[model samples]
Target chain A: MAQTNLLSPPSTISPPTALQLSQKAPRIIANPPTSSLPWPLSLLFSAETPEAWVTHENALYACLRTHDDAAARQLLDRLSARFGESNERIITLRGIYEEATAKNNGELEVVFKKYEDILKQDPTNFGVRKRRVAVLKSLGRTSDAITALTMLVESSPTDLEAWAELGEMYAKVGEWARAIWCAEEVLLVMPNSWSAHAHLATLHYLSTQSSPHLAPLNLSLKNFARSIELNDSYLRGYYGLKLVCQKLIPLLSESSSVSKRNQDEDGPPPNLETVKKLEELATSKLAEIVRRYQPGTKEWQGYDGAEVIAARELLNRDANTER
Target chain B: MTLLQTAPKKQTLAQIRQQRSLVRGINLRTNANTLSPSSFQARKAYMVSAYQEGKFLADPEGRGKPRPNPMSDPAAMEGMMGMMKGNMAMMVPQTLIMGWINAFFSGFVIMKLPFPLTPQFKSMLQSGVGTRDLDVRWVSSLSWYFLTLFGLQPVYNFILGSNNAANQVTQQMGQVNPGAGLMGPEQDPDKLFLNEAENLEVLEHRWILDGVEDRLLARTAG
Candidate 1:
């Protein structure tokens, strides 16, 4: 159990405030702001020893861990100022994280520019690239995110995560075939990738456009089931399996009825109406799975939990209309 | 042979399960480092907490990772032994009461003191005589008939059980299996055992239980 300290902050125990510490700092080498600095140099301060820098890093990490936004913001401010405005990529990224979560669009735009600058300087920083992808996706720049991720995938085929991200971006943009292809690519690299299988299943089961996709849907469900076989706690794979199963149920029902007639009938032509209904039902079920595992109220903090709940509601509305 | 040397001790199932749980947790944290920053942070915090709690030794700047040895830290070994001793001490009261109760119910009696007695005295006297006469005689007969049962039995069992538990903990450590717990069903028993063997060199150095630790480990293998 965590011990809670109820005492007041210690009085008269003054740690050097930022201004006092900065006064003892060395002069900055007057270089153009656009020039790329060694990544670590961008983290320097006037009199701060490596030990103090480490302590600051540890403090920032602790704030992030405990979900203390205010402390995290203060640390980010200090780091950004020390590194100078143009080169504080990490600090700027932290700012973006803070702003994105807070839904401060103006703040998000400011920090996003910094991220863009970081990417321009070194596009291969996979960590920054992934975070940038998330920011872009959240900001509704789906096309741009996809282009960036596509480039990332071309360069790093071994990174299944990049493939997964591309697959998700494709889905957001309604490029179902590309999404399926990306998901499949991930499974090729990591045969037991539950997320990839889940994405593929979602695309096939939820899309109403074609019949060729159903084969991959079955395959995706099987992969998902295999992932579940490996780790039962994988709620994502379970949600995917549930969506596929919901879709399969109606198709199976239609087939069983047709089989009784003993007639060579091409399966009931895709009824757009029924297909749309199945899509809504599958989507709703996926949301319900997420909601059941959603962490409680105070800990909610604008998480996947809310997105999951909203997605479920959207599916329910669609399903209700179809019914 | 002495009581401790008489039989090769075995690891109990509960000890195995507990160790597996801890090892599995450590593995989950290790593997989480690859996919998520949150997991990396959590693992770092967990390590820090374990160090603070004295469950693990402090990590020096560059002198290799601190391996937990049950034997090297005399204080830790003493603490575990102390717990076993405390548990053994508890058995004394349990046995004494159980022995007295068994004797009373078995229709044994001391010399009947035939004098008119108060009801209170009668009950108290009956209990005392029952314990002394019935228990003492029954125990004497039992010692001759079933010679193996002794006071040291509980103590030895506690020692072996605790040692087995500690060994299992060493097996489930984070350094041993980095991603074991996240997907429990996928965990490899053979791999876990192999890792445990590799860790044993360090584990043995911290042997918490004097002679019984290895003996119990061998029995557990069986």
Candidate 2:
């Protein structure tokens, strides 16, 4: 796969990529923007492309992550100069800058207070509200974050990001049921997302560890199967599927002779033969993924390095047990 | 005629701005990363309950109040004025050209059609020329103007890229009739949501991964 570009922000930024992007900041910031004169006069000067602004914004983020506050501040000044300080997006960016530069909890709390004041002035500023929630989360106030997120979602039921964040917070606090509900809410909005299926499956698997219930395990198995079905190449889905099937196989074999009374409301448990086959399939798939996704390979460079290593270790452990 | 055509262009730009504000008000772009799915039967069940509870109409500001009509806003009125000014700008040059053509090129054949035409087209193709026996293939200057008026669409598209406002035919057809768009102000969003929910209810959920394992195994074996 081609390396990701810095002009458009990526969902997750690794430390090395952040460093690389921040190193380009001074060069990007050195170029002065085109003079924003009236239309005909503006045309006489060199025109600034929208991509330049996007690059400036992304460079600021990268600088913030790499702790290059000077470069970040310069980029921020340029942005505010162009768009004005009162622009809602610029306000959010400024809030993020303050949060990043805060040295202690007291300074962070002051930043949080600023967000609160911004929200009080314009309650409709969802960006500042989200920042406030983030500040709460960073302050180790999980319950308060959950409360704020719940209010956010109640007002905007279709806000899938808030729902996902709420689910993660619930999972953090071991509120498995609420986390599952939050995941289901996300599923309601986006019906074709394979990653959501894998996420819900992972939540179920985690819940199963705490409660040791056959119901969650079965749901986890079906969801993992559904996720892999949606996206055949999803490594996380395959890994979860293999792990769940391995756990289910032994349990199913042990309970083979037990007389059935009440059927599970979720679904019937997997058959022993099917579970064993799924385990074997998962094992083979994981082995293939690990082999094909070798380091420095051009074709399969998309898989995360850590995930491939984990899959290889799982395969090795399985071989050792079998031997 | 120009006013009638280009009015909708300005309206569309204003509509886009309004929609962007609405999207930003709910933080849609910043929170767009999550994904989800469910079986149709289950989704239908959820939608039904959700609709009954009025979840679709939930206000993001947490106030249970309906929003004002976007078309009636002052911004839309300003857009209407801007569109009028644009139409006026286009009309002056158009009128000047028409007068210039009438003064200099009336009653003259400007060009000929490549293919033969029936005598029925003689009046249309030789509009300004009064000669009754003139071949229908010989196009008058006025007729040529009309042809270019309708036919310069591809030329405009070539020079200005696809979505330029200079195309007259598209401008004529693309008039934004109030309450005619997908999310028009006059349409009740509650009804639209209910209709969509009903449609989703009947949708059959087919799992695409049904025989995926077999397919994967076959590919690997081969």
Quality class of the docking in candidate 1, CAPRI style: incorrect
Q: TM-scores of the models, in the given order?
A: 0.35, 0.75
The numbered model that scores best in DockQ is 2
Model 2 RMSD to the real structure?
6.6
TM-score of 1: 0.35
Per-residue C-alpha lDDT of model 2 across residues A1-323, encoded as one tens digit per residue: 34656865655777898899999998988786666677557645744778888888999999999999999999999999988998888999999999999999999999999998887776666788788899999999999999999888765555788889999999999998789878866765675688988899899899988546666777788778777767778889889988888777777777776615435544466667666677777787888889888756677778888998999898899899989
Residue by residue across A1-323, what tens digits does model 1's lDDT show? 12211121222212332223222222111221222555445334224354554444444544544455566556666666655554535644475446445556566666577667876776545666677776777777888888878766654544667878888778777887677666655554554455555555566565543553344444444445544544544555555655555556566556755534543221223233433443443454456455554555443333344546655665576479779
lDDT of 2: 0.72
Note the residue pairs that clash in candidate 1.
B23-B172, B27-B178, B70-B206, B71-B206, B71-B207, B72-B206
Q: Which residue runs of candidate 1 sit more than 4 Å off their true CA positions?
A: A1-70, A77-112, A131-135, A208-214, A233-243, A249-323, B1-222
